[model samples]
Target: MSPIPVELAVDAASAVAANGSPRKTFFGHPRGLSTLFMTEMWERFSFYGMRALLVLYLVAPHDKGGLGLNAATGAAIYSVYNAMVYLLALPGGWISDRLWGARKTVLVGGVIIMTGHFLLAVPASVSFFVGLGFIAVGSGLLKANISTMVGHLYPDKNDPRRDGGFTIFYMGINLGAFAAPLVIGTVGQSSLGYHFGFALAGVGMALGLTNYVLGSRNLSAKSSVVSSPMSRAERTSMLRKGLFWLALAVAFFGAVALAGHLTVGWVTWTLTVVGLIIPVIVFARIRRDKDLSTDERGKLTGYIWFFVAAAIFWMIYDQSGSTLSLFAQNNTSSKLFGFNFPSTWFQSLNPLYIMALAPVMAWLWVALHRRDKNPSTAVKFGIGLALIGLSFGVMMLAMAAASGGVLVTPLWLALVYLVQTVGELTLSPVGLSVTTKLAPKKYASQMMGIWFLAVTAGDCVAAVLQQVMGDAFLSTTSFAIQGAAALLAGVAMVLYRRKVRALMGDVH
Candidate 1:
């Protein structure tokens, strides 16, 4: 791709840096915010854009420019792919803290991600899996580090603007997500073919990289510095160990391939099992740490509860890309005002709702805070879980309405997304903020990695659930079961809120 014009980049930078010093302020916050916001917007644009096409491309007939895979296999691959994206963060965050630092890690990740998209633009199975692998590794590096830098932008943990900054940063994420399906999905799935969509995603990543490069000067010194540097001898020893592990992984996968056992099912199950196990081990280790004070141990216990809530919420929410997308295509009405909408467009609803409601929710939190009536984090988490359950409850009703082999109105799916978006606002940002706040200083980066492991575990569970649920995904019975499970979890959280709050100490 051609480089973004330097003149335009200069002009944009100047516009964002109207004050004397470019580092001083932009839109009443750090000028670095502009760079981070735009960078993440484009990164998400690429990520979601490609995701919108993933399952569709997998299940589409080869004659129609698709891979012709079964729905179960496609969903399995998708779940594993997403799980790896989050799972690798454990090592990615470590590398950032101990070696590359956030800035270099993000830059390397962006390049890898761009390459992944371009590889996906190739119409071959090998390229497809390779591309997925690259994107997963790249995203693992970029996601947590960028958010870490956002926190770094505000040194004062008590800064009232911190939450607002994250909220605004989150808006960037949604904005990219909102645009991807409408633009990339529409064009890529149309006469242009799926490869075109992949290409567009690549272009988005390229732009993100460009933005990051041009605005690097505006970033705080903290963004570039390694938080926990190691000696050269230590680094060399670590590198040798990493290489040994990498070779072992390659050998194992090569053996699986040679044995003709390297199918999607195998990959999916392996990742699922690993994803589930890692968090358990991590939590056990943390709980056993002899250095932790009683207060710290209590906070860690409270964090586990929050972690459980987050994992459950994500398992349900992430269905939007798998079973839910299939429902939109096969079960929901596509017509509105006499025009048939692309099923992929339904994927846009969550981000659209998020973009519209995030600001309102942010303001509401602040407004309630002023009155000393803001809900505690635990309560908000309960509310979020309940809202997600309600979203599925809407799905159950929609399934019932379509019981007779008829397509239900698309509005039902839209309503589900709308409710889920509200739930997301309640849980996601709060989760990110609290993870940073609650982490022990020495293990800060690893704690962030652990937070993502919850997401990985959720995706793993989702994969297994997708396989087991299968076509039941289209039935009212399945919806009812899932919805009820979420509601029960939410109610349980509420009942335990007082205990959790006590453990949380003064953090809330």
Candidate 2:
């Protein structure tokens, strides 16, 4: 797409800044904020919409227009899919920095994602796997770059409005997440074939792309520039190497599929190993970089701590899709006020709570910051872990009450999600903001990708934990163990707060 005219760009930025701060436009932020807000809202609608239906579609009987996979296998597929989505971000970010600029990468990623969803809307089995692969790669590209663009919008790292801008941006994420299950879940799980729901997700992505294209002008100019452009010789050599590996990967997977060895378990275990290795390699590279100053290295150390803490939190949080999702479907009573709701709809609760609570939390942060009483990011991470543990504790209680074949009330799960939402509010947005702050300028997007790898590691761990524990996930024993572990981790973080703060140098 053509860049926005310089005169118009200048005019728009000036008009948005008329209130003395550019941060004060479009609901007290830049005009570009509205563009990103809507674009992400729709993108999330597509992503979460597909997620709500994924496991359900997998486990449903073939006659019922589903794959009919067993629960364990289905969960494995879900985990692997999620792991790949975030895992590919490492290369996605690298490509954006070195070759395609963020703008072009996002555009290409959107089209690829939309294509993936549309392919899934087809009823064939081969289409299903291909579609998933497409979406995973596409999301890896879009997710980190879009977020990096949001940070780019406010050039100043210490811009007082930065956190608030991120929170507002987060609201867009939750908005899409909130509506996905309600709209897509209802349609997809209803009498309309599951593929129909998949189609709707594609439509949502198309709208997002359209919105992005129209508002491309409002985006910062830097977003369109390749951060580290390559020379012609370097580009040619890199392309050849990438193509060779791409061909090798396709052949290897094709061989596995033809040999009937591409089971869900195989995919899960393979990616899990790769996921674990990637972060270690990235961290080691960062640590050994001679270009990094002492303070930068120190901040890098602090980021690693935050990374570990966030990964642990996601291990518990991501169960919402796998173990928690199954629990809602099979163990919780869906009836309320004489109407039986779809179990998939329960997936909406976390985002719903986030939508309601995000503004309050955002306001709370700013209010506290003004008084110089805002909690440090490390403290917020601790609070997040504690809240997650408490949520599981509540779940354990519900499990006990529902022992002996009685289904627990759906309200119990909702309550769990409510508390978890508070924990999410405390950690997620803060994690994103701090990642931007702590990263060296040369590795900004890659660091964001590393942040997402935490989710990948967590998802992989959750899948393995669920499989090993088996029915324990449905019992109080498992809940108790998880709850206690999280609580202890939270306490540990709180104790280490001072040391981590010191490692962070001047970063707040």
Candidate 3:
């Protein structure tokens, strides 16, 4: 918890500014940060907007705006979609690094996402499948790189504000997430709502893309570390040969086998195989060639453990989009502020809570650190896991209060989200900045990709959990067990914190 040395902090800041960002804080930080902020805000708006409606659209009666799919199928498809979105970070990172650079890849990703939303806007069943595919691919491309670009704005070592900057960026994510459910989820679930909401998500992305383009003046130039040296023409040609063919292959395979239908099992295996191969090779090569000091290697090892622990946490928390959303629709009493809240809109509670909690938590950490009593990353992560577990315990309690399928009050749902958001404040942004700090320079993007792969793994597990819980247990019971498991895992990590810290070297 010691403040990073001034020398190391300055070094980190200079590294981020290597792409020609101004040395001084603009509007309290780099000017490009706001541009990235707005871009990500709208991007999340689009994603969460679609996500809010995804399950409801599947389970709602056919005449009343849904496809009438059962909970299991919808949950399965939702899980696979979520998992693939994260898994796509591998290719997405490579594309940004080796072909178009981050800015161009972001632009291209926006277009694809908008197209996907448009496809979803269409009423035909075929368009629904097509739209989901587009969104998945587009999300894969945009989400990872945008975050990487934020890190690129800062150097890897010693910048205390790097963690804080990611916290601010994390705010943008929640802001969009907060808005989407209120706007798109409402419109999509009501009569004549689905198409309107889908179109709105698309337009949101279009505006985001436009804002980035117009605001390019305020941005730093591409980081040469991530940008390929090839000219635009050469890079375009290479991308055509590589990504286009790969896309075609994926399409061919998906169409012939897994296309249109929700192939949860297939997507999971595909991503897992890709994840296993890519990270092992990337890390092995980095370790082989990079003359990293013992300290660096130790930090990297700690990062690996942190990644594992965080993945388990995400698995329980991410059910908001799948199992939790379904519970809100089917079991929760939705009346609030004298209105019948749209079930999908309840998904906003976590982000809304985050917007309120993040800054407070930030200050608390600083205060704790100042007192020389701040918790280690491992301890915070353990707390995160326990909090996640506790969210489910609340759900179980709510279920017991409701009695025999009676609806639980909206307040109960709100409390669960509140706890989860606090846990997120402890874990999510902290993990992001820590990963950036701990990863060796030669393997930063690859390590980030691996972190994302851990997320994918978590989503896959959540999906399987959702499916099993749907048939075998009450929703609250399932959540309770998952939460307990996460809490225990977190406690285990805390008990092992000294060893983990030793392995990680001097993260502080």
List model 1 lDDT by residue over 1-508, tens digit each.
0011111112224334345444455556667888999999999999999998898898888999999987877876787788899998888888888888999999999999999999999989889889999999999889869888888877877665565666667678878998999988887889999999999999999999999999998887898899889999998998899899999999999999999999877887888888899899999998888988888888898999999999988888887887688778778888977889788899888877766676688778888999999998888889989999899999888888887779988889988988998898888878877898788665665787888887888888878876777755557887788788878888888999899989888897
Q: Which stretches in model 3 have alpha-carbon errors above 4 Å?
A: 1-34, 148-170, 223-226, 230-300, 468-470
**Candidate 1 lDDT:** 0.84
Error (Å) of candidate 3 at residue 226 is 5.8
What TM-score, over all chains together, does every model reach? Answer: 0.90, 0.88, 0.83
> Of the candidates shown, which would achieve the greatest lDDT relative to the real structure?
1
Model 3, position 273, has a per-residue lDDT of 52
Model 3: which residue pairs collide?
Answer: 16-155, 254-259, 389-483
**What does the lDDT come to for candidate 3?**
0.76
Residue 143 lDDT, candidate 3, scale 0-100:
78
Model 2 residue runs over 4 Å out of place are: 1-13, 16-33, 150-168, 217-221, 254-259, 366-374, 440-445
Largest TM-score belongs to which candidate? 1
lDDT of 3 by residue, 212-328 (tens): 888766665653355655778987888689898899988877685754653544554554455445545655666666588777777777887887788788787777887778878
Q: After superposition, how far is residue 370 of candidate 3 from its true place, in Å?
A: 2.5
